[model samples]
Target: MNFLNVDIPVKNVPELDKGFVPLGLFFKNYQKGAAKPLCIAVERSGGQIGTYETKIYGTPEMEQADAYYVDRLVKFLLWSWGGFKVSICGDDNVAAAIRAAYSEGGSRAFDKGFMEQVYETEFIVESLPYDKKPEAVQRAESIGRHLDGGRIGFDAGGSDRKVSAVLDGEPIYSEEVVWFPKTISNPDYHFEGIMAALSTAAAKILEKGGHVDAIGVSSAGVYIDNKCMVASLFLKVGKDEFDKKVKNIYTRAAEQLSSQLGYHIPVVVANDGDVSALAGAMGLGENGIMGIAMGTSEAVGYVDTEGNICGWLNELAFAPVDGQPDAMEDEWSGDIGCGVKYFSQDGVIKLAPRAGIELTGASPAEKLKEVQALMAADDARAKAVYESIGVYLGHTLGLYAMFYDIRHVQMMGRVMSGKGGDIIMETASRVMDEEYPDVAFRPEAPDEKTRRVGQSAAAASLPELK
Candidate 1:
């Protein structure tokens, strides 16, 4: 796997400094031959060059003429400046394209070093694929299956904070939950349990002839770069040892599983919410979108451009409100994060106590069921509570819209759907219209197809597999 660094050289100091243009990336990989890059970075300036950014959705192979036209345009721009210059970091194809674009019949003119190329030992930025969307997805899926046993994910809860190995969008393997027993005294208990749990999942995957791709942990916290846990919210694991310990446990489990399965594969350790987002973002269904999971705490998520789960997508808990600047932190903190304090199950409980509801008589889940019953009965009090909760939910969702730069927000967990879903959705739409008339917010129900596809894509990203 080689990388290409195509530098679009320009003279303007200001434009270059600002990284004005959003360069498009395209590349091709071969099975039996060397991989080559079909690269181009077209920069437009406000002064001499007109400022314009257009997109070509198809690939270089599918849209050969379009790619060629782009190549020619880049060459012309380069020559118009002084000479066409490109830094080739992959195969000879990068150099060849420049030569062809600047040749005698080519559009650009060059005196001497028009096609001169050099091999520099520096980090280069190669573009990601922009063509053959279906094919690219298929390739990614294949890679996922190859790397892991169709699983790559994370999970977290009260005493169950662990990464997972998912396949076909299901948790086939998981890291052990760290139980924080009130009467317990041993420090190693949590770590030992987690290791054992991870090993158990690994053993199960290997038994099925499925490989291990990546490990994703979902807990009550924030994770970044799939490497470190920012705030483990309610988890007992410290921020310091999360990276090292999780990796070590996953590595040992993968090795053990591979030995048992007669093969070796790579593993990734990540946060659970991100994995849930990956499951949702890969189009799990009609609502195949923004994943908001609330258990001990709440987390909002979406898949990023890198095909990885991202918990930092919205962080609506930290969002600032207009009339109440500190409402986000003051109102939406502690047990609920953003969802509960305003919209989730705990929010319902909070409302319950205020409305003389008997929430103490039943289990939390059962109590939630009762809330849904109240909503179904069309009780005026329950209706009002649900509607208000819906508004709060929508407000958070609106934040998701602005942050992700996307519109559709999928509502997950027990609190957002079923008997209360319609009320919540209606309120979300209404509030979105009131707060942000310019944006469109459509809520969707979950489905199997999107989940399967997302899982497939995530699974395809597993590395170090045969």
Candidate 2:
């Protein structure tokens, strides 16, 4: 793999310093009978230019998959560089392959509407002409004064929802209530449950003579323009009701709560992964952080170098991580070798039986609990489960590095809860040091208090709060 740095001129570009960076991503399969790698050229304001190239090698089908992966990597890079308005330049074949992959709806489907949402630009099959009209750039919502006065932060998880009453970046009150979001088919159940939780938090603020100014939400699934495009929370609802009622559930719930409270507050909802990344960034006081939560599923969020969350679909759970022909299959997507199978609690449960440990529990969660108990007692079989996960982490981190200039990865979720978490991080670090020494990055896990505070505080900061 060869990486060359070159300066390329972009024509008729608006001044980037006006809050948006312009980037051109080029993909070429063969150049002079040799496979040309994925190339990205970025131009910021003040006459600055940077180019990045990474080699690609595989058969036609594999290379096509690589293109999809490269597309995701380019999005991450451009986001980290700063807010970007990107132009994708590639030949007819590259463009068609990407379009087909996204259309097929599998591991390659995550980037389906990515270009339209994040970059506000389209993919050009032919060579990009020097002069093209740039689309009107929309600046991200400002977080200014959102975190100040009083705020309610909520994080909706698989089994429980967490609510926090925050005053100027500090939580005055917080609580967790268990709710059945997945199995409930009625949208009213979800609506009532969510509003009740927020009401509890709002009451705390009012008790202290503080008025609720805004509500920030972090939830699992895809959110576009503050609406739930696809989420597990509404999976059981009928298609018609899911589309009509459950789509904007959060915003609607907020409005109802606002009416009851006799004041209208701005409401902001974002992907949980992005909130986790934002939390990690806030906790560390740094940028370029990718936060991966390995709980019921693998959730990912990234904070770019400019300390802004890129609105890209960081749905890395379904993103392909292993290219081997016989990788483990995701039961949900039936795709081979996805990130979810290796990063979530499901990953550990799947590996339990393989390690020759027979779990007598009835469910996967119960089986996971048994494994954690074994690890607590220093059982070798339980230890091996995490060690293998460490190995997975090392390899996946290498793969992730190809796409993200990740400086720090904050590992959260149930899988990283106990002694098992320590072993996983230790072994992964050793693997990276011994096997992938060239990769310059480190992984860290936050303490319990820090994790909770960071999560709620970051949730409060989502509307771009100062």
Expressed as tens digits, the lDDT of each residue in 25-120 for candidate 1 is: 111111122233333332212112111122332334534433443443343333222112333222244345555644555423322222221111
lDDT of 1: 0.43
| Highest-scoring model, lDDT | 2
The TM-score of predicted model 1 comes to: 0.53
* TM-score for each candidate, following the candidate numbering: 0.53, 0.78
Model 1: per-residue Cα lDDT at residue 87: 32
lDDT digits (tens) for residues 1-466 of candidate 2: 1112212222211111111111121122222233544444443322233345544433564465456445544444443442223333333345455445545363444343433333344422222322331333323333212457788888888899888899887789988888989999989998988899888989999999988888889998777667886787777999789878888999998899889988778788888888888777676767788888898888888877677664556777876654444667787656666688878988888788878888899877788899999999999889988987876776677667766668889999889989999988887787677645788886789646557666655676666433
Give me the runs in candidate 2 sitting further than 4 Å from their true place: 1-146, 452-454, 464-466
Q: Pick the candidate with the highest TM-score.
A: 2
Least well predicted 10-residue stretch by lDDT in candidate 2: 13-22
lDDT for 254 in candidate 1 is: 52
